[model samples]
Target: MAMTEPTIVPESSAVSVSVSGAVVGGLRDVPTTTLADLLGRARVMDVVVRPLWQPVPRVAGPAFTVRCPPGDNLMLHAAVHRAAPGAVIVVESGDLDFALAGGNVCAVAQRRGVAAIVADGLIRDLAEVREAGFPVFARGVIPIPGAKSAVTPLNRRVRCAGAEVDAGDVVVADEEGVVVVPAARAEETLTAARARLAQEAAQSLDDWEKAHRNRIDALLHAGGHEES
Candidate 1:
């Protein structure tokens, strides 16, 4: 069956106020994968993703910000024109109630050079979205359509999973998971994350050897006691 576009409910939504240069250049440089590693390191609530039903093929990209109400996707349609190459649109739905993204948008996003779509709400049109093959991570996939009555301010700062994301934030997603790094924090995060990865890599062999030796010694010690 052909996938149909979901109806979006429009609402009177407002964009968060930002002072000069607050969200400007808010795009971060840390690899999206690096942030996922850091989250594992610190046990932080860093991995903020909706639900993963279908997998979007891995691709490189920057983040485009859009704030919308639950079930409203008006602003998202507008963002398609403003998106840059390798851009991923991060939709912050006010509450986790509506299906904010779906298949039709996925087709448009891919055509506009979007790398992925991350939404805090549900998504519809799973088969087409997967067929289009634009990476999408949402709360889950629901057959329900979205409401278009509420307003969704484009290129505004909005809270996503306790982290504030603005337009142009660097988004990286892969098999491990999704991570958002602020433009301001990218350099530092990347440097530190790289160092940590290198250190772990260098020590991995030694650590494994040590564990093997310990296991052998423990087993020998048990055999000796039994013989005695």
Candidate 2:
């Protein structure tokens, strides 16, 4: 028997909010560290899921969530073709023993206009993926390829690298790490991040140091550490 496509849940049931270009652009400008501060540590992905190659450009887009079953990569491969251009393909799988994807898969995803691939599992063909300049942030790499028999669906909630990601959530990632902005708060977070960025830009290093030092001194004083 042939495998069938995963059933997409009705849109009415799952409210997929569209992320705007302004949000994407603003997020790309801001740092993941800044977003981490804004979103808290829980919103940030684990440090283990880092860029395969250093100096990779930051990617920001609405997530196209994919859930690949353990030991199988059927859904992730299907996602490249289904995801819209500028979508960040986020895969949720804890399978470390097998690779979820390889070089060609990354290339195809890139050619199809995917912003990047953030996987909790491993991938093969590190050299080829790096040479192609495709962005892949995952646990690590493995030589053995994963079987593509486990058929799952597209656009679903998934947990990738300790962060729960829903479809259409704003995904901002770069060298630092990946951060997911909930769809409902995408614009709100962007405005706040931009404001914080602007404020920081206006202040000089000396100004920041003085304020930072003062804060530490006050906290220490409150803690009963008397000034000598």
Candidate 3:
């Protein structure tokens, strides 16, 4: 029996639409916590995919989702070229045995103006990635390289870090974690997040104490505790 080479799918096969730059730019400063709060803490990605370095601020942009088999990075390679300048490449690799990205890919993605990368898989070439100053959040690091034989689809809805991400969805990642805001709800979500942030910023210690005291008093009163 002879082995057959895998077919490389054209970039057009993947469904992706460039999100408006204004929309993506508006979310540049929106914190992941704010987005999480807007979503009721439901759309945040798992904590496993953490930033490779500390003190790195936030990265926000439209998502360019990639669904690929573990140990294969062909789809990711394709996505890097197809993604919009400010898009964040989100990869859903099932396992961590193989490193799906490394220094070379980071350099290419950086030169291409990719906002960042968030993968539910391992990556290698930490030194190079760090030197390139590309923001990457992933499960962990591994020395083993991945195969490029499989050509996975790009820009489709995919589950990454236990969260479902769709192409054009707003991805906001910070020191805390990553959160997704559905494209359809970006405007309203942004409004709500801004309001919430303002409210939190204006809240004083006295206000917090009063709110906590009121809650505790209500609980005690409901339990029939009488004050002397």
**Among these predicted structures, which one has the highest lDDT?**
2
lDDT of 1 by residue, 100-209 (tens): 76777778888887777777667788888777666787667777766666554466676665566666555555555566655555555566777876666688777979
Candidate 3, 1-228: lDDT as tens digits: 998877756543343444566766777678887787779655899989899877666998888888779778878877887787888899999667888888898889989999999999988999998877789998989999888887765676799988999888889888889998888888777778778888888999899899999999999999999999
The TM-score that candidate 2 achieves is 0.92
Kindly report which residue stretches of model 1 are placed more than 4 angstroms away from their true locations once superposed.
1-60, 94-97, 208-228
Better of 1 and 3 by lDDT: 3
Candidate 2 per-residue lDDT, tens place, 49-102, comes to: 999898899999889988887899888888888888998999999898999999
Off by over 4 Å in 2: 1-13
Q: Regarding TM-score, does 1 or 2 come out ahead?
A: 2
For candidate 3, give the lDDT of residue 62.
Answer: 86
